[model samples]
Target: PIPGWTLERLHKGYGQALQETEVFYDSQTDHQRLRVFDNPRFGRVMTLDGVVQVTEADNFIYHEMLTHVPILAHGAARRVLIVGGGDGGMAREALRHASAEEVTMVEIDAGVVEFCKTYLPGISQGAFDDPRLNLVIDDGAAFMRNTQKKYDVIVIDSTDPVGPGEVLFTDSFYGHAKRALTEGGILVTQNGVPFVQGEELTNSMRAFKALFADWGCYLATVPTYAGGPMAFGWGTDGPGRAVTLAELEARAAAAGLSTEYYTPEVHKAAFALPGYVRRLM
Candidate 1:
């Protein structure tokens, strides 16, 4: 907030962002505008290109759901790849899986990595310093296309499909991502909230359909994001990627993952999308 001015997200046609807040830091990186603020309900909030990326209070819901759903379902994901999650939340969660021996994260902008590490350290939980993480400062789309290294699980923790993040949502990127994965590997992406951006989920599923034999999406309620439930795009060549609750619970227990938002039950329930969201598929 400056003088009488306030930053707000129109959220497509959903209406105004409801949080009343105070700006802590705001600047324009080489790629997009970044803003860090404090919301009374959500605590610390990070926004890029005028979109809320994460809030300290509700971030676990988004991070855990996006990371664990695929990792746990795959049950033997050792090598993981994360694209665009410069904040490090995805890496933090992925490392919690005992099966993960190495995690390679490719982020285009070094500024986002440093900014979040300095200002939003809680979000990453020092995952940047973990010996197992390989942090690369390079374009994510290009890295996926060129890397000879394959991953057992790949998570695309990208911002909304705008500004620098738009390329990640394209079919070409999805194709390259599929090639970057090992056999039976799983890929998950942050498709926007279907309540407001139904087309985002629809388009992502369309791309997944062209690339993977089996693909679907799941939902998680992140209070930081307005409109409604956020959809996470899922894709895999493995037809048996979706396992029963009993199988997931056993895998999670074996992994010794202690999480607030993601449990075996929640993992099973997250895929039970509402009718309106299912229509997008």
Candidate 2:
């Protein structure tokens, strides 16, 4: 209603007011629209294609669940692959494991990486500067299809399945991801919130069921992602990948990892889906 004020709303097939900011940076990259704006309560926020990807206030919840669950469960994943996390927050958590020898992050957009590194340094904390990280600018699907390297963990940190991100949610992409991992390796993906985006979880779970021996979905709540708790798709052929609380506690101590939102107890609890979500999968 003001003459000079501008509003930015997140359009998740439905519009919701996210923030209104006067001081912000916006970019039109070759891949998508990237905006970083300051929010009074959430601190700095990043949105891609009108969807909130991360906020300085709650990024740890998303990045931690995305990284730790697979890495910690695998017990000794030295080689890791990250698909589409251009902001580098996932890589930062993966690198915390001293066992991680190499982490290859394949992001389609170099601009997203450059911009996030410059503006969201607090989130990634210079993860791009780490020697163990191999940053590749390429399509995630193409990289998965072409690479001969096998990783102990492969994480799909993609945006929603639209535009350039659509290819990543295909069955073909999941097949390639399964092939790119070593035996006992695990693959995890961002599957959106089942409360608002149930079809996304169903589609991903269907693909995983056909490809992996043991596949399931887990949960984490990121306030910025709204609607409900966010789901992460889990697929693996590894025996005993779903560890008990005692097993997780032992590994957590061994890894000596410190986290804000993820604990061994929480990790075990995340897989306990609600009744409706259980039916969805």
Candidate 3:
């Protein structure tokens, strides 16, 4: 209960408090209570409804893994679809691949995008202005249900499976996302930390197992998304998951990407689930 610190009580028993060096934006949006503040260690931080969403320091780990893994694994992801990445960090990473000709990002809240652009531009880094990006402001599940256009890779960069983001974790939504993919396309989702949010990952994986020929979860240790490694749900009818390490290395070299946390080795190693997480899948 420090005077100036913002305590994020996402879990019932666990919480993280960041000392707010400067409060940037703290108010209500149409969907949730959006707060953007400056912290000494994490730099700019954005929180939605008292839960930390993204931070300047370690966003690269989340964004890079979510975008690069599927795109690079697919090896020719020309069209990408992003659901609920309003902050534009996902788009920034997806657009990094010259192979991705078009990246369509569907976000529910235009307010989140607007405020993120104004307050946390460094996280997005001019991705919203990219010519290849087709920004659509809409509900992610609805868009997936109706969109006739197929994608090589679809990333569900949504918040925790609660409130507005709850629908994104449902079996019906996973079915729609599976249908929205082109032949041999991949679908990845932001399943929460398995240690704390085990049910979330299990539910998503259950749906994925029913919908796709291949279904599993991967690990990424994001400092902000506490409780061990955060799991990204992986579901695909494609052979992307079977891609070898040598091939990934070649792709990384060809793309010539300069990343902070992602590499070909990391990409391959991410899928090796620990025993506890494996039981959830």
Top TM-score prediction, candidate number = 3
The residue-by-residue lDDT of candidate 3 on 151-218, one tens digit each, is: 99999999998889999999999999999999999999999999999999989999999989999988
In terms of TM-score, how similar is model 1 to the real structure?
A: 0.94
Over 4 Å off in model 3, which ranges? none
lDDT of the candidates, in the order given:
0.87, 0.88, 0.94
Candidate 2 on 106-185: residue-level lDDT in tens?
99999999999988898888789999999999999999999999999999999988778999999999999999989999
Question: Which one wins by lDDT: 1 or 3?
Answer: 3
Score every model by TM-score: 0.94, 0.95, 0.99
Q: For model 1, how does the per-residue alpha-carbon lDDT over 1-281 read when each residue is reduced to its tens digit?
A: 45523445647445445354677788988788888877777788888877788788989999999888898888888899999898889899998877899999999989889899988999999899999999999999989889999998999999888778889999999999999989999999999889888888999999999999988898998876777788999999984456988999888888888999998888888888788988889
Report model 3's TM-score to 2 decimal places. 0.99
Q: Which residue pairs come into collision in candidate 1?
A: none
